[model samples]
Target: MVDSVVLVGCGNMGFAMLKGWLDAGMLQPGQVHVVEPTDALRERAATLGVNAVAGAAQLAAGLQPRVILVAVKPQVMGDVLPAYRRFAEHATFVSVAAGITVNFFEKHLGDKTAIIRTIPNTPAAIGKGMIVTFRNPHVGDSDAAFVDRLLKTSGAVASVDDESLIDAVTAVSGSGPAYVFHFIEGLTEAGVAAGLTRDIAGLLAMQTVYGAGALAAASADTPTTLREQVTSPNGTTAAALKVLMGGDRLKNLLTEAVHAAHQRAIELGKV
Candidate 1:
């Protein structure tokens, strides 16, 4: 029995992490096993040359995976998790299942099981994801580091000692992509209304967001400074910002939205 990585639920997010690991050469093809119940998804996983099975029962006895990544949906987690408790002895359980807390896993697995709860966004599908993780005390530094390297295949990796903060992380990064997408959609609509062709409007909206994010990542200037630099005295940009920031309308609205999402995350964890 080789040291392998067991990936559960080969959906978009799970497959993304698996692909990232393989693409980055962080894990070899044979070092991974995917337990995806869906035929279509299992077929897709096999394309990566990894061992794809319909269930854990197909795995060899005495085989122990170093990491068991649980990526199933939160609602279905209770039924899916109990099956993996056997691996708690040797595997560090890592979960990207939204709203499922580390305590929940320990309750299902064992209290001593090394558990790391993570919130990874959809951007992971394209290797631009942001993952925020909180680990239980049972997880040592080396184990946490291993999880970090595995997640970095998709994008950035960050750790939080406090598990409660994961709720805020979910609101910020986990569901954050949709907020950015909505902004892009709004910008595109504005462009279309301003007389641009549909295709041109879409291209402009997407490129602006892409370029701005890249600049923000590469530049040392603060976002506020960058905004000021773009807003000239009585310029079009300033006029737009005046409406957007005049009464802090957009800021307040976004704050409300994030808080709503955070509250919902906390509520979901209770179930």
Candidate 2:
């Protein structure tokens, strides 16, 4: 049972996960503790009825959390994490800070400590995020399952067997949201160019993307099949495909972008 969870940062993503757990009844306010130095963020956590402190020193005495979630910035982790060493012997450390590796946490906490690393996207703020996690071998199945259940409250959860795949996951799911956002921007611009009002264009673009994503997710058919289904011979979609699919323009561009993101993730890990 995850009786107590300590979240070290209360930023947007961290706060979203906390809200999901509370709203889903996966966690009780009294069982949650937040450590954030920022006054505004601390007050925000307090508004949720959880204990909020400026630092680990203020955590209740003799209270070892079941999970210690590190959500701080990657650069500050080196300075912020050492204070939680007392819990290293007992708690499972979970980090959502991108670019920081399991090795970093293990080194700070203890080699024997169980660490779980996750990369989650911004959509999680709306309970539609996709999160990919990797558990250190020291972590057992039960602990991993508990973490998975907790994460599911926010969105989808997938376990990665190999830690190396986490960088790829970061590139695909973590950075992928920005790509989709840019697509929406482009679509909205195209709609406006086609003589629609700006507001109407924005609405249509957003809804179209949302519907398409939902349909793709709900169907078992491959995206290629779905695209083909939409492209009747000599149809508008076919005309559009002539520009996008011609020479695999969209495919190659996306591949290049994801590869660049993956390389950046690797560099961040080293930092």
Worst 10 residues of 2 by lDDT: 137-146
lDDT of 2 by residue, 26-93 (tens): 99999999999999999999999999999899998889788888888888999998999999888999
* Alpha-carbon local distance difference test for all models: 0.92, 0.91
Backbone clashes in each candidate structure, one number apiece? Answer: 0, 0
Task: List the candidate 2 regions with Cα displacement exceeding 4 Å.
Answer: none
Task: Quote the lDDT for 250 in model 2.
Answer: 96
Q: Give lDDT for model 2.
A: 0.91
Candidate 1 ranges with C-alpha deviation above 4 Å: 1-3
lDDT (tens digit, per residue) of candidate 1 on 1-271: 5558999999998888999999999999999999999999999999999999999888778778899999988888889988898899889999998888888999999899999999988888999999999999988888789889999999998988899999999999999999999999999999999999989999999999999999999899999999989989999998999999989989999999999999998998787
